[model samples]
Target: MEDHANSRHKKTVQPVAKARQEVYVLRDLKEYLGESLLIIFSVLLALVLTEFINKQHEKSQTKELLNNIKEELKKNKQAEQEQYVYQQGILKRIDSVLRDPGLQKKVLTDGTFHLDYLAPEGVSLHDLSRVAWQVAQSHDITPKLEFKLVEMLTDIYDQQARIDKIEDKEAAVFLNYESRKPENIRETLILMRDNYHGWAFDRAPALIKKYDAAIKEIDRDL
Candidate 1:
């Protein structure tokens, strides 16, 4: 009778132990699922923050480049305005020199021939001067003279070549020059400048001297 009772009690205890094991396994599964979800959320949040930072940095770089371009454009416009002003001053001075009766007579009859192309037409010197100042901040009479000098130099250089056959000794000296390009004829000009008094016996060199002065002024200002 006692053995039978003992067996019955063991059977009841075995089912209870099995139920406890099932409850513990379910609790552990729930904890593992919660931990996995938390890890995934953290990874996604970090990716979003990194993306936001990258986009902000790109936007800043783009803005900086645009600002730089604007500054460059502004500087270029200002420089152009200044150049226009200087050219206007030069035009005014040229018109004045072109109009003076005495100067015109000297230009034509004296055979110095500086204003051969500048005709007596268009606006007066005063008006042009005003216009020039309105356009540019500075007056520069040098460019007008520089343009004329370039033409005169070209003519003078041509004359030298023509005289080569007539004066072989002088031509030989010219040929031996380091560079005889028309542009390099400033060397010959300096020689003439040094011996101006002796050379003036033949032709009035006022135009040439004025041309030289204009070039010097331009160089100094520019």
Candidate 2:
């Protein structure tokens, strides 16, 4: 009887010990799962915070670029206006020569000419304030700018390039005219007069109008 009682007690104690072991395993599993979830949450939060910061930085950079570009446009517009006025004066001078046949005769007899009447002093053959544009292009920021602004900027720059080329050609022609002999003076004066008239009346005024439009747009946007 005593041996049977001992066997029953051992069986009961073994089952109790096994149940406690299973409970401990479940508690450890729960803690591990909690830790894993916390780690995932922390990583996700960091990623989101980093993205937000990057976006803010980009916004600030883009705004600064726009402001710089706007300032440059204003300067270019002013330059265009001044250039237009100067070219108009040149055109008037050319017209005076064209109307007076005696002026051509005088040039031929004198064997001398004033090249200043063709191209003035302040007019440049290139866009001087293109640094802002160069920076924007190098930074690849066109896509960030307003569409209309980009279009106007592109058009204005292209017109400037065309004007520069024309100015260079006109300069070369004038230089050649100056080097010519007395017999060729009249023909050279006529060519120079016609070139100046065409550029001053047509090309220069058109470019000035474009500059005005661009300036207005930039002012409105800014």
The TM-score leader among the candidates is 2
| Lowest summed lDDT window (length 10), candidate 1 | 121-130
Q: Against the unseen true structure, what C-alpha lDDT does each candidate score? A: 0.39, 0.67
What tens digits encode model 2's per-residue C-alpha lDDT throughout 1-222? Answer: 999988878844443455434344446788999999999999999999999999898777876776787788778767767766776776666667666776645544554556654455733423537777778788888887679988888877776666665566566665674535765655665666566556443666676677678777766755
Tell how far residue 9 is off in model 1, in angstroms. Answer: 44
Show where candidate 1 strays beyond 4 Å. 1-28, 84-222
Cα lDDT for residue 63, candidate 1: 42
- What local lDDT score does residue 105 receive in model 2, on the 0 to 100 scale? 56
Among residues 3 or more apart in sequence or in different chains, the pairs in candidate 1 whose N, CA or C atoms overlap within 3 Å are: 85-136
Cα RMSD (Å) between model 1 and the true structure?
20.8
Give Cα distance to truth, residue 173, candidate 1, Å. 23
User: Residue 150 of model 2: what lDDT?
Assistant: 88
